[model samples]
Target: MSIDAFAATSLPVRVGVQIAPQHALYPKIREAVQEVEDLGVDVLFNWDHFFPLHGEPDGLHFEAWSLLAAWAEQTSRIELGPLVNCNTYRNPNLQADIARTIDHISGGRLIFGTGSGWFQRDYDEYGYEFGTAGQRLDALARDLPIIRDRWTKLNPAPVRDIPILIGGGGEKKTLRIVAEHASIWHSFSNTETLERKLGILAGHADAVGRDVREIEISTGVELDFSEGLLEAQHALGVRLFTVGLSGPDYDMAPVRRLLAWRDAANA
Candidate 1:
């Protein structure tokens, strides 16, 4: 196993596990955080969705930021944040303040992962207009800088400069935003898609006069990365790997294996 995995970098490659808060009781949701932190996971992420994404779509669910605040106070050693906050749900300035407060609550370990949201139900239910993907991405592009500038200007300020994580892999618009703004860019494509998207992002970085390497590449690990896949992604500068699990007695056998992969890669 790579000894340090995500934590191998000077800035730490960082492994993230997202706990889906839908379809689970509060206690189960509560214990999931304790479990991952105990397992030495680097980051604990929660999605900013109101309802279940899968497995009985209309099942019981909880709010996103409230859960995050609970997680922030509950854990002491792990970094915690939304895998990507839905920019449509909250105003950018308000989102910045919420993140800033959580940053202090977590004692300087919050990563502000955000994206142009896609879920129509969330927008309709919350009275946020469900716009086109291009429209939403455009709004996200606008909000990201506003949020960052607000972070710098917020009273008492964030404990540290919160790392900006721009989620989504839209080659034309989203990747350009990643090159311009994100400290971490989370994508859910297979190795092939990632390669193509990274090429596009590199072009965006060049156009923006930014180093592509400054932004970390992250992908989900529902299955192991093949040697060829790993080598290819690594060659393209992809480092951080994430595995997502949902609540109420969910198994973590996969996470243990991924953790070992991380250790081996860094060994």
Candidate 2:
């Protein structure tokens, strides 16, 4: 898989910021969201988790969907959603309705990123079943179609065909589901891993009769903006780069650098 292989599908580079909702107050989180949106990032994301993923286990954290609804109203330009909503948290139809509602609220700026539920602690604490990885992925496969169908049956349809971003790189099931349902595929992969996964994903897409290049590739970034690293990813068809900022301080410097990189790359 080479960059030229995806050349016919040239995608504009996009930068996103994930504002982690743990260990922070609601007001502070709100302020961070506003600041990032103002900073001109292309997308804004918050993770779906019951508790903090890092640092203190009992840190102050907020729910994902509810905060997304709030963010829909809070920002106007950036597309918003959970970085990857847990599929098992709510009924698929209900998730669809909720996503549709938020899509309407945001006037069509929603990116419905979802995944097979993980994090045993979130399941244990919230009373949802903690199944095996395969089981969870099976559930995700079953529900995605239902979610899409429910979107059609809603009283008021979504303002736009809500873009579905499936997060994960499990080559067997996850990539196949992404082939069938996703508009974007989000993952954390280095250059070699990304190239291999993209090749696997393309095989899956072929099996399902889809063009893999149609799916946008997204990944996270660190503070140190390595030109060589990003260039390698760009060559392998990744266009959407995201950087996550944790609570308390929600630093914007790295985000600014990524934004600048995005502008330069797309220039």
The sequence of per-residue lDDT tens digits that candidate 2 reaches over residues 143-258 is 99999999989989999999999999999999999999999999999888988888888888888998777899898878776989998888777889999999888989998888
State every prediction's TM-score relative to the real structure. Answer: 0.92, 0.97
Off by over 4 Å in 2: 1-4
How close to the true structure is residue 262 of candidate 2, measured as C-alpha lDDT? 88
Best by lDDT: 2
Per-residue lDDT over 158-256 for candidate 1, one digit per residue giving the tens place of the 0 to 100 score = 889899888888888998999899888888887678767777887888889887657777777674445566555655566777788875566788778
Residue 58 CA displacement from its true place in model 2, Å: 0.1
